[model samples]
Target: MDTVKPKDRDFIQTVDDHLFCVVGYLHPPDGYTAYLKYVPSPDGKWGKDGRRYSRTLPFYHVSQVENTYRYLKEKYPQYLFDCPVRNITISWVPKSHVKQYYHPREKLGEIMSRGANDFLERKLLDLSTVLEDKAGIKNRIGVTGSILTETHNPSFSDIDLTVHEDNASRKLIEALRELKEEADLVKPVTPEEKEGWVKNRAERFPLSVDDLRNIAEKRWNYGYFEGTYFSVHPTRTDEEITEDYGDNTYHRKKVVEGTTTVSDNRDSIYLPAVYGVEDSDEVSEVVSFEGLYGSLFEVGDRIRFKGVLEEIRGKDPHYRVLVGGAGSPNGYIKWV
Candidate 1:
């Protein structure tokens, strides 16, 4: 079976026939195996009446396919792992995974075909138009999240936009800043929403209301528009998306599991997202590749995390416990 590359959404099946969404880039360092985040399994074993069965939990945290299978066998030895997606044969675990590639142009066409009154449709069109006209890379923006999955409720869903090229991403960030100030098209988030956002984020990490707002205010790529939240995630163009890190090589080291205290999140808006942590291990920073958790963790709260550790050796030897390295569930955060 072919590997699941970046920008692809996959429906993965385990040996027990349980299904999950591969939430991010699926090409693990070793192409033969996959590292995946556990989504609410789309299993119909439980009745799916209305929205009652829409979500399920006790979700297995991020794990490799074989590891998860082994863990389960120890608990429920009678359960068998057999189901595999197309083109994959079941080994101890199935090698097959089902994936759907994300096409920005095709998704844009679908959104355009919707009538004018559709809230999400109008928001997407306006944002794309602004980025295209100002940055000249309109065609590179792709929709993700609820809108991309077609499960969005126009009245409630926020816009999740992707800018494919690095240069384009920089331009989009600048453009978004200007839009928030001058364009009536993008509106400021209501005080109520801001309060709700602060409270919700504080519960996960220990940050004050002001600290949360300060980080958010600096990020030009996300804001409120038309009474809804929107975020622009910028990723390198296909040609630039490589895994090489030169002399600073990395690997999937032992999972660092502990409760640590957060000290700072002032630069929470950027990549290799950092937070000063202490009284845990030698690890000084909680670096996250996923943007969602960048601002999610704040100062003072006791956070429990398990992630791939990358250690740099030299005169200045230090460690970084990377969270959300491959996005949610595969990487995680919780206030203890």
Candidate 2:
């Protein structure tokens, strides 16, 4: 079998049968850094290829991922890794344990070639085709989530699309914004949908419904596609990834609260969204592993944030605020 290089948005099945979703581009030499997503269970709600599985973590909920660490520690300790650089225990799947590698781009090609077998797949095809033409990002987008895993239920599963390359991702978002204005094929979430979204997030984050609504309104990467709820996740290509694994070591400092102006939002759409900030001497950047905060701010916007401060050590040391991880239950970034 060919050796697969895992990147963000890819999925892997271990020899022990545990399923994990790759987190980012950087990794140690011996393993792929990922998070546990699914595990086999007799009474599991999700099924793929006749096997049942249960979800271990909730989508976009960092607190839940932290809680999951306890479960993993007790049941599958091998998946837990003590990283010397990050100074944290995270999920890392050993290279030798990988039974299969599921690349989002590859799965999407297969689907597009073989054709759709159900309603959800048909909608996915239509959505991808439209995005390819309108955004001029042909072959740059891929399907993910339950659809990629072949565990989607046609009745309720939402479409999850992944776009590779940072520039293409931004272009796609712009295209979606234009499409929403031009046609009904693509539209922002309805009031009802927004209400549901706000309510769901309010339960997990410290933000209120109004704050969540305001953030949701500013996003263009997720909404309704032909009446089906869908989300577009942007992944950075190898060329765009600047830091290598272990280049910078992060050490937790203390909880911080302050207001700052967003100076740059170029990399705000990607996972572990990074933001350049000004008007704050203590913090040079704000980094979030939580998906909710991605693309939530714009340049020149003033925002207040509460998160853990970290001291990054390398050739040039700096301070950054990290949101959405273990021990950061109250962490949040909101418009001022």
Candidate 3:
């Protein structure tokens, strides 16, 4: 279908999903079982030799295998041939499964609140999972946004964080990833549709990040039309996230540490980060590598060691750890 549009192509990732698939029909040679599809190169399709080099032959992910016949009837309606064209199919994987974009037509504050509410609604399922699976959980994860919906318009890259649990685990992360694909996201303040209340939206609703992002995209405040979306919470703030996702048991007692990695691009080097500091009678949550860009730091050099928990990039593919140093703070302190 040539579904790859410029905006939808670059940021659009064919997320690996176990749920649904999209089968494609391509122009193939007669009697040929399969043909090598050529994806254009970054440079250009036609080279000096008028030949194309390597291309990523993407795999298709289809759904509802039981309704293959029905699917064929819908897609290939005119062709009433009894047998399905076996080799005539070319597959395109699903890319729009995340969430549909939204178009806002109201005040900016209204849009921001709507966006926040939509984000919260989407995490309801995960929150339910956390509530059901965890043991001996004491603290509650608070859900809120960085730009508190009080302004006329919310800024770009604003965040909505849901903190229903105190700690996040690897197992929990996998579960969350699964939850994202299990269903598409929904947005309130939808035009002409019956609106859902805030309570009903947040508790029972579970949405994909894209769903909330659609809200942002439609609004004018943020770089909405730019088509970028990311949500960072209080914990994800400089302090909390620097530490590993609660996998720092080795350094928990002696020296505390925290670390995070890029989602992909394993070689992508980010600024070093250090979290946890003891300021006399107080504590600093996190200190980051970018925080030390100029002052007492030089280019091509690692972040200098500071308070007890210094965030260090580790050797393992996704391993980053922090260890205790001299006079580390008590780790926890009540905010005044």
Candidate 4:
């Protein structure tokens, strides 16, 4: 069997049946830096192919990731890795331990080939087709989340689409924004829905409801399709990934708070959302790994941010403020 390299938003099933979702694009040669998502258990709520699995990580929060790290440290130490470049201990699945590799693009093609078997599958096809026709996005979209794993509940499982290629992803969001205005089927989240989302997110983030609302308003990736909740994740293609693994080293400095104007936000849609700042003596970029902060800002938007300052040592040395995932609990970027 050929070795498969998992990219961001992809999932990996270990030989021992543990499920992990790949993190960033760059990874160690020996293994992938992923986080545990599900584990097999008789009492699990999710079942597929006669096997039941329980979710270990309920939410994508820094605290939850830490809890997962502790759980793995106690029981599955083999999956833990002491990363040298990042200088942090994180969950890593060795290449030799992988039994199955799941790619979002491939799974999407398989589904599109077989045709829909249920209402959710039908909706998935309709949604993808609409995006392709209306947004000029073709063969660049994929399905993720529970649907990708074949454990989706047709009655309630939310649609999670991965839009590959940076340009297509950007175009998809732009089209969705316009579609909401012109089409009846595509609509922005209702106030009641926003309230529910705010309440759910308030437990994880430290921001106030008003702050959350402000951030949510700018999130073009999230909304509704045919009255069904859905979110579009922008993923970079292989060619779009400029930096390779071990290209640079990062050292976490001290936490810093400041206000800066956003100079560019083209790459802000991806995970580890990168934002170019204008006229900053200490830092030039603000990178965030939290999903809530993705696509949360625009060019020329002045924002206040609190995060860990990181020194990047490579051919071009510079400083950047890192938000989310071990940065700091209070780390955030908001309108200034």
**Candidate 2 Cα outliers beyond 4 Å, as residue runs:** 1-5
Task: Give the top-scoring candidate (lDDT).
Answer: 2
RMSD of each: 8.5, 1.9, 22.9, 1.8
Model 4: per-residue Cα lDDT over 1-336, one tens digit each: 235445678888898888888887768888888888888899887767888888887778777777888888998899998787777787889989998787888888998899987888888889888888888978999888778887677777789989999889878988889877775767788778788888898877778889898876777877778778888898988778787678888888888989999999988989879999987778999998888888888899998888989898985588999988552556888887
Q: Write the per-residue lDDT of candidate 2 for residues 250-300, one digit (tens) a residue.
A: 899899999999999888888788899998987999988888898989899
For model 1, the run of ten residues with the poorest summed lDDT: 84-93
Q: What are the lDDT scores of the predictions, listed in order?
A: 0.54, 0.84, 0.25, 0.83
Q: Give every collision pair in model 2.
A: none
TM-score for each of the candidates: 0.58, 0.94, 0.21, 0.94
Give the worst 10-residue stretch by lDDT in candidate 4: 1-10
lDDT of 1 by residue, 113-198 (tens): 76434667787887777767766665777776545544456766678777766677767767777777776767666567677767
Task: Extract clashing residue pairs from model 4.
Answer: none
Error of 3 at 323 (Å): 15
RMSD of 2: 1.9
N/CA/C clash count, model 3: 18
**Residue lDDT tens for model 3, 90-193:** 33233233222111111222433454344433343344334235422323233232222121122232333233212442233333334333423312223322
Residue 109, candidate 4: alpha-carbon lDDT: 91
Q: Return the TM-score for candidate 3, rounded to 2 decimals.
A: 0.21
